[model samples]
Target: MAVTSVIASEASLFLTPQSIIFDEKSRSQAVHVVNRGNRTGVFAIRWIDHTMTEEGRLFTWKEPDKSPWSLQPYVRYSPRRVTLRPGESQLVRIALKKPYDQVPIGEYFSHLNVVMLNKNVEESIRQQEEGSEEAEAGVFRVVARTGISIPVLWRHTRDQPAAEVEISQWNSSQQTLSLQVKRLGQVSTRGFLHVIYQQNGKEKRLLDPHPLVIYPNIDGRKVNLSLANRALAGGKLYVYYSADKEHWDKPLGFASIQL
Candidate 1:
């Protein structure tokens, strides 16, 4: 598995509105990528397709086979290469191209990947004099580059999917919780989830608000979390979800399971 390093908005830079949606009449939208680092930041922007699987994992592709959910061919964004000084921002405009009549009837998804280049290392290398001790040591200095990705989707139809969840596996010995979240209906289900634990008249809350998205290509996601407490013989976990747009943080329904 690959490890990811997350950067906060003020220190590292970020994209405003991590996700985007579109109305039927809108043709284009723009996203801003800001640089909060001390040095000039270089970014290489590109569009990629992601397919959610039945097991709830996302698979990305540069060019995928034609399907109801592919978003690569129709998406366009610029300026693909950006050079910004510290605390500067740039606009990346995304537009959808057509043969609209040929687009499939379900939701299509794509991602705008804003990848950061190792500018500090490049700067260091440029300043090095020939055959110097400092230059020889500079070759071993590792550069850790980081960036952000945003999901953009266009739904061609009006069918909104229903989402459901169940505890598929719970390992009390390991203090792990596993849930199988399923999505129904024609469109994807994007929501927020809150997890709580209860035992012996006491309650404990876990997770500091999370985003939930179940796409059309994936039927369900199997999520695993660890429970730390060991004293209770009987414990139950309660979970709730709500749609993202107008119903953010409000639970439409909740479910519980005994451990």
Candidate 2:
């Protein structure tokens, strides 16, 4: 009988300040990337543009040549590639090439992607080819190159937008809540969502700090959140959209529904 064993390897990378925002006052920004894995990590960084659907699905911008809303054209980054050892860190600096006024009065956004190279995977493959006894015993290895993308947005000085939240739909059987964040005014707004379940006299938080973004081109975004394994009978659900993840005291939008 041949015994099979599977080994999985992945890169451990951490990023600080999940999102980046640039306005007239700020000229540049920095993103910190740390390697938490024991092995050295090689990463490639670049800017990518994406469009969001009503259901909050991201797709690469199809019309790159005519994508007026893309922020890639005006933005620049440093250190396109880097090699980080364990407990090492690198800073990726971003700056705008064009003046703030030169841009149109709207929100432009793109994603900064940090992708891990498969150097470790190649090493593993080379080792397996050396013919160890464990390899003869049917040892299979699977390696993954993980990557992260963060939204980077730049808004004109005159562009200001407001957001409002509404409960679009609900499914009791599926324990799901659907919401639409409506955008009003010129620019777009990005923030986080918090869902609270109030039953009897006690309250339970169902969703804490989910990303919410409504671009300038779109009227609103549809977000569906699942509330599985949580008691929702005879309760009132409150949803709040806040400017940042740290504080919910002042919400940009608020909505509630009774079950």
Candidate 3:
């Protein structure tokens, strides 16, 4: 009998705001997770209150309606157990609840934990007592710890207006796509351009550009997208933007051109 050693790679979780702006109503925050490991890993996370006092810092756990721990208010698990096969990565969505006119104007903090479950702990212990030929019984067990900080800012209302996106032009000869965007109001916007086309009622993504950052007051910025050697036979082109990658808005601007 041969034994294989199992080890966990460095795993981490982070929120875009690190600090967030919360209105009276409930608002959601986006979190990105990176799995830098050869095997799949699982994570368990919850939000705990961390209040800053004159002396130093005081931590309190919040218990929401339904969760794993009583002290933790909101607990979430990745929808599916993430299986990362050598350099694979994934993202998870988390929602933060803020009751109307409840929280005061200040900085609030919370913690998140990424854990890996041990699958071979019992087997390892049993093998050790049997005097197996293998020198060591190799132990695999679930590991968990808490060490992530989530900072949030409370505000009354949204300060800026939503952003607008459009597809300016499409060049079939050159196999390139051009995009133009206008800032309707003033809100720091970040999103990517996703081009989807339909053929025989079957939808497929034509080109996905890297997420672009649009600052306030920037009238129209052009993003060059390459669509070379792609199947664009008979389909309509659609372009749109989104605050979160998972959810995308309707086609603000579009053009029907053939390649």
Candidate 4:
């Protein structure tokens, strides 16, 4: 075999679409994972039970959520173990096992953890490769491989409407923008965040649509965005939060920075 240095880790894994949302009537859908690096990419897939902390961080636990919409038990995905050569891709199909009519209308959620395979083995391989080079040049050192993970989410809805959102508090200092989001209702909101500035009828967008999710059962989800100093320079900065861009164009909440 040809050796071109495996190094610490390979940038071989790529995930498309980023997230998944399944309606009550929908049965199954697919996600694509591609390998873009020179070496082979191996991965393992499993569902994790997690909840959003009051601080807006993810806390994963072995005990699943008791809600009817829990994605861990109902949604089944295939090809849990994936191995792909360079430039190759695989399809991971997901389907719901429970009957939609029987379940209550609410948002149940879980995460699909796509983890890179074999951390210890990869370290051994990298160490051996490094040692071989050191033997030729008479120098020795140890380097290890790094793991990569992509977060996938699944949601189920039953005639439940979209939730309302508001920015109860927002302020910026130096380069940091902080927000306290108030999410109303049992349904969670998943979408991208947009930061725009307008002055003299001209608009400047500091940040485009970036994925964000604020779950339920808390005072609210707190979040912060780091911006360049020029993002809010001499302009009216507007923070717009919205989902369903493909279906709706209006923002769910609008806020401006003061003090």
Best by TM-score: 2
Per-residue CA lDDT of model 1 for 117-206, tens digit only, reads 754433644566345566566655566767788888877777655677777777878877777777766667777766777888987766
lDDT of candidate 4 over 1-259, digit per residue (tens): 8879645445366777677767655678888877777666677877776677757687766567554445676677899988776678889998878676676556667667677664344445676877766568888655443434444444445333343445554444556667666665666777666777678789667765755677654546676777756635565767777785432347666577643
lDDT of 4: 0.64
Query: Worst 10-residue stretch by lDDT in candidate 4?
Result: 156-165
Model 2: worst 10 consecutive residues (lDDT sum) = 118-127
Candidate 2's residue-wise lDDT over 123-217, tens digit each? Answer: 55667788666667888667576798888888865656567899989888888988888987767777799898888889777876898888766
How does candidate 3 score on lDDT?
Answer: 0.49
Off by over 4 Å in 2: 1-11, 119-144, 169-178, 196-210, 224-237, 257-259
lDDT of 2 at 15: 81
Q: Candidate 4 at 244: error in angstroms?
A: 7.5
Model 3, position 246: C-alpha lDDT score? 49
Global lDDT of each model? 0.71, 0.80, 0.49, 0.64
Candidate 3 residue-wise lDDT at 203: 73
Cα RMSD for candidate 4?
A: 6.6
Q: What would the per-residue lDDT of candidate 3 be over residues 25-80, giving only the tens digit for each residue?
A: 64555555554544344444444444322222344544433322221333233443
